[model samples]
Target chain A: MASFKQIHKEFVAALLVPSAPIPKGLVALKKPNITSRFAVYRNNVIVGLIAALKSNFPICFALVGDEFFKALAVDFIRKNPPTSPMLFEYGDEFAFFISQYSPADQLPYLADIARLEIMWRNAYHAIDAKPLDIAKIQQIDAKEHSNLTFKTHPSAAILKSNWPIYSIWQGHEDNDMVDIDLEVKQAILICRPNVDVLIANIDPAACIFYSAIMNGRTLGNAYEKAIKQDQNFDFNYCFGQLFALGLITDIAAEN
Target chain B: MSNFRLKKIPNLAGVGLKAQHYKTILQEKPKLGWFEVHPENYMGAGGPPHKYLTAIRELYPISLHGVGMSLGGPSERLDPEHLRLFKALKDRYEPWLISEHLAWSTHEGKFFNDLLPLPYTEETLNHLANHVDEMQSYMGKQVLIENPSAYLAYESSPYAETEFLDQLVKRTGCGLLLDVNNIFVSANNQGYDAYDYLDAYPVEHVEEIHLGGHSVELIEDDDLGIGKLLIDDHSSAVIDDVWDIYKKLIAKTGPKPSLIEWDGDIPEWPVLFNEAKIADGFMKKHVSTKVKS
Candidate 1:
């Protein structure tokens, strides 16, 4: 009799790698057709996992065509099986895997694109929060603004990329034919003001400021960092832009 | 609210609610007896999933159908994180039923993301029953154990699948979800008689049922040349053969709260509702007539 742990381990191993040896007690219906039944399970498991990944990373699939994406997915699944039962969270390490994947090394920006897609998925499913009311912020005194620590909204994502990922993503959207340029760097911000996801280009200074806020920096310190990066960093314009996008939700007193 | 505490779900048909049809269903308030959701989808802290679920719960009964519990495993241990989230959702939604698959999903701490089958044996049954008992104790309510749509069977199983399920329910006092499509798929895959399996099932313990579509694939075999394999893809329309079997099972078991599951490539809301309506019409015609006579 196989222990529960041994049986489960063997079952999963058989499902993951079809060629893995089945446990001692497991039987073949006839003489030498040992791998027959296990092959069915192995196909189902791999196909299901790949389908889940494709659903979660549709944009990633679009970037890399289906054949290449599926091949990469098979390797990725074998290397990094899911840590959690929640399928929505199964591909957390996919971007990291893509980074080290040698076959995909020709597309240096593929990993970052995967990261962007993951962020979009995260923002889509993040906890819902009411964006800061513009009228409420206007009610506060201008003098107290520097002392206030602004908290970013739950649906806010700030990303910086050396490739024109926004164009690549948008081109894929309408099935538009556009040549990919290898020399463009883009900083993008994605926010959910209401229900629709809105993506926009952001300046490097504002990206730094938002990134700082995302990392728990005080508003004044983030502003200082933003200005240090770019001498002509428009604090008022960037602040208004962030507020308009509903990225700032909570405000705390700077200690 | 009525004081009637249902020991078993009434034999009425229901629909699996999707986000695309949330507003339409809520606004129209269709005469659905119940709704089922995959608990993992709503495991987040606060979001639209919960919001829509809250609104829907006020109108109809709900069932938290879990897909990731890995109930049929070697160890009798339940995932604490999954349990906590499920408990929280149950508390907030106050669903009428909770259920999970009779299959394992994880091994060595790595989730395979599919409901892998288990060999039916005394050891596996004991392990699964204890897990079911633990889950019921933690949730403070009985759960329905649904039969999985398996693609293959292990050659080393000592007990029949139905017998394993019977032992599980006997030990844990848990009910059965009795997915008829799954029975069809598994029977076809394993070259067993689906009708005989259904007839032998402990129908009294069944509280709910599931009906879904499956896709067939032809695999080459050395001796058999090509063999037909039924895959429970849940991506297309329900087949006539499965529906016929479902009607026969319903006739025998009486009306149970059944659900029409179309998970992948889900069609327009009306198409799914029409399918539900078909099942609803059958239940009303058969079960209600039996009650009246």
Candidate 2:
């Protein structure tokens, strides 16, 4: 006489843990043997969640190959079953998980690759907004340019990584054979300025500047932060890229 | 709430819309009765999924078949966040038919992503009926609940699957989406006659029908009485035995809107489209034969 709650608790417990025995009260029609039958659900739960994870982190899957990815993904799925029902939102913590996973320490950059993929996915589905045209910025008085604050597009994001993640991601995207320099620190700007998601490599200085503006810093303050990182940081280059990519949706001059 | 008009999807064969097929569907505008999508897929704020869905919605009718509602969950109530997102999709798309499974996918705030089975008991019935009622009340329209494909049965269950569903419908005033392949798969796995399950089903309340393919695996132990277990993978074409059951169902229910759902190992657009045509042929043949009678 298991209560519904008790039965469901047992059911879900076994579902997440592959080695757990079948919960009590489950029966098959023909014979008492329900092991294989129950195993179907265990397989479905694990396999289905693994599939969702695979779709979410395709680059991570590609880097590790199928076997390692499946094993790693299974561990991740069992440990961190999705809190949300939306499959697309399932693996937000996967990048963080990969960073701590010991087996993947050999490929230290794999976690950052997962992060870039997540960023691309987020950009793909981010809230749509009209990109601010250059004409809008041209109207801003030169004296007010440095004092102007910018509103980043909803989909815009900056990722700075110790590994050459942009090159690895680009190689996968273009299906090209490129010798990635592992020592090179890389930063990328990810956004959906229009219909398609765009991911471009950005200078480290620009990453700091973009991060500052995205954090609601004024142009002067963002530029100051960028120059602090690199004495030769080019403000015009950073501002040109932002305006060309339409990453800024609105700008407000300080009163 | 009163002015909401649930668009009527034509009673013809449709295909489960996949993202890969979106471009082809928009370009070809194939003569599909309607397109069906899992509302969870479109829950994102805005993107290609929405862009293509919007374009296709203009040319063809759409139905939202939810896979993550957790309507029969053990929790006290349905997930409010999921409900809000689903409601937004329904408002934006205005799908002709909205449906979810009788099984639960969430427990203790973790989503399993599979339509896990529930036991059939008076308490279970009451719980499911309340969930359904809440969904309908919030939706301002009836949602057809689909029967889940099962592999194992609960020993403590008191009622048959169909009887439980009938009770849920009677209490909640919701409709049913009969997935014929689920019947074949569940019956074969659970040792019940597919035709018998169909016979016991409350077909009068069925508003739409689903047709899909399943994968079969042979169990190692013959003494278990279950020689082959059918998995409703929906990765291939509908088999003849399932079609026979579907024909039998349509003969009784008379040409409900059926969909050819190939969710896994999806083939080329034409291959999936051809499967829908096959279903359309069955619906037409059954209807004409009934007209003759």
Candidate 3:
């Protein structure tokens, strides 16, 4: 028999690569060849990880349907198996994998949908933070509003996409996306104020505004960017939505 | 950590906790011995998993059953980061009992996410002993090591599976989990007698027992030949054969904390709770008869 390390190296190598011969010295009772037996472990790894991916990216699985999703997932699993034992931490790059996958090219919005799903999952599992109280906004003086920089909640995220990711995801979610134009661009917000994660479509300008706030820009700066992007950018409404949802954790005046 | 009071899990049947059943378990607060969870599932920073687990923990004694520790891997030592996370979870949850598998899922920095088998050689035993010892010391308590269900045996393995587990207990002073279904699955898959394996197992050191279901698969290979393989899928109800063996073991050893594990194709809460109730029935029947006798 080979050394313990050598056996593991060979065993793991075979487990990952389907074509890799069964590691030496593996045997089933009364049978010299153990490929069928050994394939159980192989199948378990592939199938188990694929199941984890399926649970993690339900939208992608639903959008592409089962067969395509499984093929796509298998390819992704072969390339980027989980580095950690925590299955939730697996498949962060799955959306990128879908973007590169050729078959999913026909459904161009698929990758962004994957991104939305990832965001929703992240928001669901992200660290809990106490959302800023609505009264805190009332405490802020109008004169200091320009210097006000906002802190986003731990579970807050903004996704901007060329495809109608929000409608596509919401349609699948509610199962009623009426004649969504694939050419339309969409921006989405994912936030968990308390227990449930909330996903909703947001204005493109609000996307830029939220992005700027998350990047530590002052309220004045974020509003300027949002207004420049679209004159109709309603700072009042965006700020109200952010405050209501508890997406903003803190507001500070930049001296 | 030592100052924290460890609530002993009762000698009744428990079920593996699932996220889907959190609301029901919380609202209903069903009569159960305890609940078990994979520590890996709760390793997330914060979320519904933690929230629900916290609420449930207040109601029942929860045991941390880890599947990712790779205690039997050939690494020179266990993964320190994984150990740290395990320690953190143990601290936060303060579970009454903790257990890990005898299989290796991690090798060379990549996790396969499956409990892969190991060859039971002297060298492998020594490595596993060290890993178990390291885990016990890190956790400041005895951790239970479960026997793996095997599909293939190593040609070079010199030690019988029971002998290997017994030696591990003697070497590290850790306890055994005594997975009854795994014993049945492995015995059938490897052409050994489950009864004989049970007789040989170090049941005195067993702190817990796991009763779970397994699926049967037909392996069709022109080269390897045809055979019926039992996969420890844990998706269905526990077979009567497995239950009989479980009864036999408990009949001899008295009642131990047995968990009904159903990880795949999870059924409704009632189905899972009823499985636990069945195991509870076995525990009651055997232990009462033993006492009466």
Candidate 2, chain B, TM-score (2 decimals):
0.96
Ranking by DockQ: 2, 3, 1
User: Candidate 3 has which clashing residue pairs, if any?
Assistant: none
lDDT, candidate 2, B1-293, per-residue tens: 31234557888998999999988988898988888999989999987888888888888888999999898899998999999989988888888889999999999899988998888999999999999998989887899999999998888888999999898888999999999999999888877899999999999999999999898897854466438888989999999998999989988888889999999998999999998898899889987887899
Taking chain A of candidate 1, what TM-score results?
0.86
| Two-way DockQ contest, 1 vs 2, winner | 2
Is candidate 2 or 3 superior in DockQ? 2
DockQ top scorer: 2
Poorly placed runs, candidate 3 (over 4 Å):
B1-5, B220-226
- The reply for model 2, stretches above 4 Å from the true place, is A140-143, B1-6, B222-226
What TM value does chain A in model 3 reach? 0.93
| Residue B8, candidate 1: C-alpha displacement in angstroms | 10
The lowest-lDDT stretch of 10 consecutive residues in candidate 3 chain A is: A27-36
